[model samples]
Target chain A: MELFIDITLLTFLCITALAITVIRKLFCAVMLAGIFSLLSACLFVSMDAVDVAFTEAAVGTGIATVLMLAALNLSHSREKCPPYQPLLALLVVCTTGAVLVYGTMDLPAFGDATAPIHHHVAPRYIEQSQQEIGPPNFVTSILASYRGYDTLAETVVIFTAGLSVVALLGIRDRRGGQSITTDRSAMKGYLVLRVVTKLLLPFIFLFALYVQFHGDYGPGGGFQAGVIFASGVIIHSLTLGRDRTLKAFPQRFLTILATAGVLLYGGTGLAAMVRGGNFLDYSVLGATALAGQHLGIFLVELGVGVTVFASMTLMYYAFSYRKEA
Target chain B: MDSIPMNVSGHFNYWVAIFLMMTGFYVVISRGNLIKKLIGLNLFSTSVFILYISLGKIHGATAPIASETFHLYSNPLPHVLILTAIVVGVATTAVGLALTARIYEQYGTIEEDEIRIKDESL
Candidate 1:
């Protein structure tokens, strides 16, 4: 049954990806890309990588589509024809794919338990992670506890990307606050959408918080939560006005929040060091190792959530602001 | 060599991933629009994610969440890696789109060929 579902989803994914390539209208292509991501997320679920599936659905399908649409608003919706034929590109792609397929010939059969990947560190993580990290979700335990340093670096990468966007497209209004009113006219006639969005905003935020804290027990974590929270804000901005949304989460506040999140994660590591442990050694933060691990994971996850939420919102603001100008 | 048998059906997932990767690669190199290139890049990255996740799957295993009934769980390392990759993917996409938007603003066109022509003339 699982294999059936997997094959079906992969087929749909292939169709969506092919459609995106063939479609010239940028809007339709972006929408098809969203479907592609959604189908891939379904595939992830079937593969038993539920945490990855959740993040893929939220970030890949949700935020990416919105960002593409905002970018589309700023640029041309139709693709221009290429001056030259794509024969070279096709040749290169075909050669690379053939080589990769040849490489895969030596790989173990699908779902083979004795595959080499499962032989090394994965066994220890699967067997003793519950005792060492205390998270029922092994992904969360490895992500937040065992491999905390890498997660910290990933958060910093996110921060850097947000900074790059801000640098490229200045978030501040150079013309002062005069342009606020012009951008304030949101979906004026969609009364039903406005009402529905208004009703659902609270639950979206509640779910973000739930996902943030429940990573230890389920298939969600700071990354998914942060995207969800940011999406809620983005939806509000779409239905209501960007100006109103900005009034609540001012650009200055979001910048500070984004920086603060990285600082918070690093500070947790520093605190661990101060307690006579290695950097990011959460086992020393509290009276017991388990307690310290839990505390450390909580703090870092909170940090990740904050940075992602603020960064995504800030990116949206940057893109939409450019569209208006 | 005779003892080993070809198992094409077992490697179907990898074949699908390779197909998707090539499709995205074709789109990226062939398309003239900057936005289209970004979309193709996204497709490529997502396919790589699928490849990694497929590598982690274990037969008869449940998700990595510890449970009383399920003794076996799929490998969690790939999940951790891909989770971070997904967030980073979106971050890079935003950066790419921002650059595309700025390019549109400066050159008044997002078509790569047009932008090159404009650049050469200047």
Candidate 2:
């Protein structure tokens, strides 16, 4: 039954991919890409990578669609035809595809228990995570506690990316808040959207918090939560205009928020170090190892959530501002 | 027929992933539009995501949710790695889109051929 579902989803995914490539209309292509993301997220769920599915759904389908649409708004709606025949591109792609297929020939059979992946560190994480990390979700335990440094780096990567966007396209209005209103009055036309969004915005934020806190028990974490949270703000901006949203989360405020989140994450590690433990050693933060793990994960996840939310929303602002400039 | 592996049925998922990957790569290289290229890049990374997630699956196992009754769990490492990868992927896309926007602003066109022409003329 699972294989049946997988095959069905894969079939749909293939069709979507083909449609996205064939569609010259960029708007339709963007929408098709959203469908592709939704299909992949379903595949992730079917495979029981619920955390991955959650992130894929939120980032891939939700925020990514919005960002893409915003980008589409800024650029031409239809894709330009290639000036050349693209025969070389086709040759290169076919050769790379052949090489990849040949490389996969030696891989272990699908779902094999004795595969090299399962033989190494994964078994220990699966078996010991409950006792050592005290999280019901081992993915969160591995991500937040066991391999905390990588998560920190991932957060910084996002921060840097967000910063680059800001640097490339300045989000600030130079004429003393005059430019935010450039797009404000236009938003009044969408009264129904504004009202509906106003009502739903609170619930969106509440759910983001739930997903943020529920990582240890279920299939969610800071990344998904942050995107969800930022999506809510983005929806507000989309519906009500950037001026009102910017007022609530000004450029300076968001920059500070992004930096502070990294600080909190790094500070937790520094605190742990000062307590005679290795960097990001959460066991030293609390009396018990489990308690320390819990506290440490919570803090870092919060940090991640804040950073993601600020950076994503700020990038949206930057992109939206650039749409006019 | 003899060249086909013994576990060909089991490897069907990888084949699908590879198909998508190749399609994405083809789109990336063939398309001249910057936005189209970014879309193709997204498709390629997503295919890679599927590849990793498929590899992490364990036959008849559930998600890596620790429990008393269930002993079998899919490999958590790939999922963990992919989670970070997804975030990074989106971040990269955002930056790419931002760059595309800047490119559009400066050149007034996002097609690679046109941009190249404009650059040469300048």
Each model's TM-score, in the order given?
0.97, 0.96
lDDT of 1 by residue, A1-325 (tens): 8887988898888898889888999999998998888889889999999999999988865689999999999889899886669898888998999999999988887798999999999999999988898999999999988899999999999999999998898876544655655655578789999999999999999999999999889989888999999999999999888887888889999999999999999999999999999999999999999999999999999999999999999999898887565
Q: How close is candidate 2 at the interface, in terms of C-alpha RMSD after superposing the true interface residues?
A: 1.0
For residues B4-117, could you state the per-residue lDDT of candidate 2 as single tens digits? 554675777888899899889989889998888889999999999999999999889999998789889999999999998998899889999888888888899999999999
* Predicted structure with the largest DockQ when compared to the true one: 1
Residue A153, model 1: Cα distance from true site in angstroms = 0.8
- Give lDDT per model, in order: 0.91, 0.89
- Please list, in the order the candidates appear, how each scores on TM-score for chain B only: 0.94, 0.93
- Sorted into a CAPRI-style docking class, model 1 comes out as high
Q: List DockQ for all candidates.
A: 0.86, 0.78
What local lDDT does model 2 show for residue B56?
Answer: 95
C-alpha root-mean-square deviation, each candidate? 1.8, 2.1
Q: Clashing residue pairs, candidate 2? A: none
lDDT of 2 by residue, A1-325 (tens): 9988998999899999989888989899999999999999999999889999999989986678888888888878888777778789889988988898888888887777778888889989988888998999999999999999999999999999999989988885643647655765346787788889999999999999999999999989999999999999888887887777877888899999999999999999999999889999999999998899899999999999999999999889898887555
Task: Score candidate 1 by TM-score against the native.
Answer: 0.97
The numbered model that scores best in lDDT is 1
